[model samples]
Target: MTIRDFESHAPIVDEETFALITELEVRKAVRLQYFVSLLGIEADVEDGQDESEASRTRERLASAIREEIRSCDTIGLVTTEPKLYILLVNANLGNVPLIIERIAQLVSRHRRPGDGLGELTLSMGAACFPSSARDRSDLFAQVGSLITEARRDNAERHRYRLPPAES
Candidate 1:
């Protein structure tokens, strides 16, 4: 099983969208921001207390995130220390902020448990393609770098996400 690097295997899309795709492909990569990585949190639900309750919350939020995501979104799984890797196909640096915000808000509101988790401060970061890096090595580095930048400036303008939330 040869692992394909994201830098090498870009998402195949339309021509007009090609420019946009390439731009995004090399710009947004979900990774650790500052020290807050967006990769894992399912297992960290029990930071202080409520294991069963936390588990329930995780399941609900996970469900919400998965359901809200589109079908084209690519998924990469890594069961290393207990984290899930994800890649929203055709996603880019511009839209990650919206996705992150929607997910965060949904998690916060949908997390029925409300027993522990609050505000749902999920610090996330994304790295795109060629613009962000060159090859696979450079690609990985860019992912981390972008994440760090996002973490530092954690804003609501990451770009290319869902439409404005309904009031």
Candidate 2:
């Protein structure tokens, strides 16, 4: 397996490594009095699509996210599912929404015509250290809850054939 440095653009790390880095960041935040934000992003691909198409959509989404994030941020994959984690160093609660909006716009721009794919929806949840949570575990829990809520909201909009939610 290839190893990517921390500064690499959206380098995909495993769960253990991701957790370790997040814990370290939490510690640093305690000492430095800086904020750290964690975002849980999940991509929803259309059903009945082939595995290859879904994989390509995921790759494109990841690329778009990588392009929007800063060099200090980190991305990680915790499972085979389309869920991803982004560690935003020095980002505060006020900034997470802006970052998420930017990512959504970038992903929308990256979509191509005739890709044999339906709309790729992204559900994101964010928690900031020192503001939203006491530590890494709490941060993770909050992010998870937020992601779930976002997904539910998205599904509700789709069920009613309503327009997408505003950023």
Candidate 3:
């Protein structure tokens, strides 16, 4: 089957988006702000190697993220990384949580126990352009830092997903 047949959501080209962002910056389009989010799926090591499992998890997570995003928005895989980047065109910073929540719901639905998927969960961080970043490079840097912070926060809590509330 073709990619289109399997994946209905057409992801934007990361290179092309980078170029477009450069043009947008040159045009001084400060009024237009895009929400850039970096998302990660971490899995536990089942055996001595978890590379294949991690790869599958990332692909599944990317598909879910692509489906969850708006038509106007774009999702792309970061080069040489397991992370996926989503560009929410003309979206506000406040919308970040809603976006992440959507992704979390999808991830949870897709996750299954002992299917070699491991104890997987999604982690995301978003930054708005012109407000959180001045340019594409700045935006990328900030988003990456934010994801790292999110992971660190999760580590501190000693869990990837939120714990169940006590009755």
Every candidate's lDDT: 0.42, 0.73, 0.53
Question: In terms of TM-score, which candidate is stronger, 2 or 3?
Answer: 2
- Mind sharing the TM-score for model 1? 0.48
Q: What is the TM-score of each candidate against the true structure?
A: 0.48, 0.81, 0.69
Query: What ranking emerges by lDDT with the best candidate at the front?
Result: 2, 3, 1
- Candidate 1, residues 65-166: lDDT per residue as tens digits? 665666445333333322233455555445666776776667556655644554344444454433343533454444445445444553543311122232
> Across residues 1-167, which tens digit of lDDT does each residue of candidate 3 receive?
11222345646445456446444642344554334433333333235545665666666666666777776565554444325666666665666667767766776677677656665544555666555666666666666666565576655321232212224
- lDDT per residue, candidate 2, 81-121, as tens digits? 32688899998877877787787777657668876558677
Question: Which candidate do you rate higher for lDDT, 1 or 3?
Answer: 3
- Point to the candidate with the largest TM-score: 2
Using lDDT as the measure, name the better of candidate 2 and candidate 3: 2
- Candidate 3 stretches with Cα past 4 Å from truth are 1-49, 80-82, 155-167
Error of 3 at 135 (Å): 0.8
Model 2 residue 6 distance off true place after TM-score fit, in angstroms: 6.6
Candidate 2, residue 67: Cα displacement in angstroms equals 1.7
For all the candidates, what are their Cα RMSDs to the real structure?
11.6, 5.2, 6.9
Error of 2 at 102 (Å): 0.6
